[model samples]
Target: MIHCMTSFAQSERSALCDTFLEVGPDAPTLSGSWRTRDLAAHLILRERRPDAAIGMFLAPLAGRTDKIQASLAQRPFEELVDTIRSGPPKWNPMALGSIDEAANLGEFFVHHEDVLRGVDPAARRQLDPAEQKALFGVLSRMGMLTLRSCRVGVVADSPGYGRRSLRSPKDEHGNVVMTGEPSEIVLYLFGRGEVADVELDGADHDVAAFRETNLGV
Candidate 1:
């Protein structure tokens, strides 16, 4: 059931892979205290190994996932990075078209940002117009699921990119509106709101509730 590859997503993935090699394995990432080596191992395991990938999202399998990732991390840095740059193996679902595009675009894009943001919050890449559209397209379809934890309705407005509600039926605190560029919205959706250059409008309590709730996976 793998879908078509999104051109923007694939391009971003390729760029992320290249950057990983350039920065070296020990470089720090926005993933808490994880470095590039940990991120590289994560990509390999998530894409190439079904067991490991499953464990990543399932609490019961998380320990197993960690062990496999640690083992992969122990490999020679150059070798591990090269595998990521080469992309997933052909037999892997991630090697398929749209599935890779939809699944990896955010993973790579966010992780790519994680690397840069970890070093400097001001260091931001200029995304292409099409890339922005692609991101919003993906968000439009998945925003609800990503923001399911919100007790209040959350409306996102990104101008040319269109708008969508991450939640519906205003909660006790009512609805909150988030305004920003699509890219900024994407970052906020992925749990980077504190530093994300987005504006919130609504009651303080409602806004806080929206911000505090888990926004994405």
Candidate 2:
């Protein structure tokens, strides 16, 4: 399981990095208040902070926004990518232990889409099924489907599986119905790109707002 999860994360990291490389320096920033550049810096900062990783499972909601801001002055994108490729400063077995493997998978999966959406949409098709399943399971747990508080929803069109809502925020109205291949839905929910190609529906204003609000620690 550990090996599988590691491979999954690496694949996602590669895709995200490639997408970032494709994004021109002047690419339009994401529509939300926060830009994609901020998200990229945040991920790199997280990988370097040992304390954050150790406490991430228990305090996943803590310090993320601050960490991103604090690391804004980090080295250029090229240097950051090289550091990430080198791996986390010190891998914590406990951190992975606190969260289910599926949850960890979801983290990388969603974040990968987040980065890709802000940068390059064309590369999104590269993600694999194992990665999508991991993200789908996590989004469901986060309640993204019911259009409640979740920002994304998954509509299962396959036989034997009734349509189910995944993640959204509470007090939210309307829905982002993600239909088509499960992989596409997973990528879209993670913020990879627009879901116009899928059978999804929802108010763009709400999603843009949710994306703007900082949810990380």
**TM per candidate:** 0.91, 0.56
The C-alpha stretches of model 1 lying farther than 4 A from their native spots are: 1-5
Evaluate residue 127 in candidate 1 and report its C-alpha lDDT on the 0 to 100 scale. 82
Model 2, which residues run further than 4 Å from truth? Answer: 1-3, 22-36, 50-70, 91-104, 120-126, 144-155, 158-178, 187-197, 200-217
Model 1 / residue 69 / CA error / Å:
0.7
- What C-alpha RMSD separates each model from the true structure? 3.2, 6.5
Q: Model 1 residue 111 lDDT? A: 81
